[model samples]
Target: MRFVIKVGTSLIAPGGRIDTVLMRALVDQLDLERHEYLIVSSGAIASGMSKLAFSAKPKSVRLMQACAAVGQSLLMYTYEQLFFGKKVVAQLLLSSDDFTSALRYENLQHALHELLKLGVVPIVNENDSVSVRELVGAFGDNDELSALLATAVKADWLVLLTNVDGFYDSAGRGQKLVRTVRRLTPKMEALCGEKSELGTGGMRSKLRAAMMASENGVQVAIANGTAPQAIRNAIERKIGTYFPATKPAPKKRAKAAD
Candidate 1:
């Protein structure tokens, strides 16, 4: 089954730059799998900040957008370099507007279908350069974008790779991790905190995004991105917090014309 994987900035860029080694390891495992894979990544802004030598994070929207524009190319280039001999990888930067309009949505889906059909892995990310403040949450972040992309592509599973192992009982206070959460509740919402240092969209946003994925008939999981063969393990149901598909599965649809 095809999978849409969302790799958070924390896992990809722990500091202010891209963590090439970790990224390569993850990509290596994905290359070994026969299943079709799509990656939704977040690290452009951080990458840009480093390249531009910005002492601190961008404050103004214009500055942030500029950094995003600059970083997106570098980020994609790094991915291309890493997967140079592995597979054909393509960059797909999106914004909420791309999904809001019916025409754009259909067009985007067709493009993605063609890419996947050609055995090319599509790397998607939000267009943070021209991002709207209203779209900064899970829906706007790569985490939520990945979940939505999974539904858009009719993927079988939605895997979210983050710094944390999985959803916890409390906001990092409780020692217990929610290994399997059948249903996300309000209490769980309270337990989740804000986003991490390396990324935006915290546990709260992830839970919210998971609800959207579950409603769209996609099985979701939250796992540590740095784990050894984490994606493969998650597929085998071997690790992290596994959230069952509570919604109906996607139905077969006509393929886009070649």
Candidate 2:
């Protein structure tokens, strides 16, 4: 099955620095030949922060863009090194226009299909260095981006790998994980907590993304990336909060003998 796996900044770079061990393990999991994979990754800014020795995330758009420019290369380089001798990876820096424009979206679909046919893993990230919208909170930390890509590519599953185990209900005694969500409601939205220190998206954003994908006929799973075999487990329905795909509306038959 085709999968669009989104890895958030918290898992990619917990404390500004990129975690090579965790990344390598993820790469190993993706090395399997049975499945086609597309990666939506978030770590450029954090990596840049590490490179520049910044104590905190930059607030200014220009400063953040500068950091993204510096770290984009580092992030891709790390992926290349990790996937070497296993899989060829291509980087695609995208803005919202790429998905919004009719021509651009068609072109993106063709390119992504061709890349997958050639057994290449397309690593996608927001063009943070250039896109003002993306830099100033547009894609909800790439959760929305992943969902869009999943629908565009007609992926069977969109797996979101974050720092948490799954969507939890904090109101019920301790935190209770919601295993399966056939439908998303406003109450669930109210359960969303704060965003991570290094990441812009919180559980709310992830749930929104999941709902987007599910509505588009794509199954979604949100799981903790720090766990062992998280990606595989999510796919196998062994872990995470799973959202089953919503069936498309049936077309009405044309009037006969009119």
Candidate 3:
């Protein structure tokens, strides 16, 4: 089954700059990978901030979009350089409209299918420069955007890489992490903390994304992006948090019509 791995801004940026080592590690793992993968990446705004020498996330929508416009190119450049040895990387900017509209949705699926077939990994993100509502709303984070993309592609699994190891009972107080979650509840949402200054989404957004993916029959996992082999570990179910698919769907045929 194909996997949609969402790399959060927090993991991409360390100490207000892009962590090239981490980027290389991730792409290195992708180098010898067996499964077809799509990367839903978030860091344009953060990259913009770094370029403009801004100390904090901009409050104005226009400024935010402007940063996205400038940073989007740099973000892709970084990926291009890091992924030079591996499969080609294609930049895919998406908006809510793209998924909400039927014609566009089908087009997106077709495009992604072709890209993957040709050994190209689609680097997806919300069209921040174009979607104003998405820039200001809670859903601005590409966490939920990634989940939506997973549903659009009928992905078998969705992996959300965040700052923390996983969801905890408290905000780094009671426990270090919540190992596995079969289902998400209101209580889980309540435990989510505020958004980081470097990134838009918090644990709340991740939990919401997991719920959305689960409802669409996709198994979701949230884990620490800082871990060296985090993505590989998650894929092997060796560590981090796991959210199993709870939503029921039509079962597949046992065999091709015999």
Pick by TM-score: which candidate is best? Answer: 2
Q: Write the per-residue lDDT of candidate 3 for residues 72-146, one digit (tens) a residue.
A: 998899989987877689999988888889999989877887777777888998889878977987465998898
The TM-score, computed over Cα atoms with residue i paired to residue i, of candidate 3 is: 0.91
lDDT of 2 by residue, 92-130 (tens): 999999999999999998888788878899999999999
Candidate 1: tens digits of C-alpha lDDT, residues 1-258 = 788999998877666788999998888887434778899989888888888888677767687777788888988998999888788999998887788899999999899989887878999999887765523452646777887898899888888998878887864344688877777788888877777765778888788777788778888888888888898787687388887788778773544457
lDDT of all predictions, in order shown?
A: 0.81, 0.88, 0.81
Residue 35 of candidate 3: its Cα lDDT?
Answer: 71
Q: Show the lowest summed lDDT stretch of 10 residues, model 1.
A: 131-140
lDDT of 1 at 151: 87
Off by over 4 Å in 2: 171-173, 248-258
Candidate 3: global Cα-lDDT? Answer: 0.81
After superposing candidate 3 on the true structure, give the runs of residues whose Cα lies further than 4 Å from its correct spot.
Answer: 31-33, 138-140, 247-258
Which model, 2 or 3, shows the larger lDDT? 2
Q: Which prediction has the highest lDDT against the true structure? A: 2
After superposing candidate 1, which stretches have Cα over 4 Å from the reference?
A: 31-33, 134-140, 172-174, 252-257
How far off is residue 184 in model 3, in Å? 2.0
User: After best superposition, candidate 2 residue 201: deviation in angstroms?
Assistant: 1.0
Which lDDT value does model 3 have at 242? 84
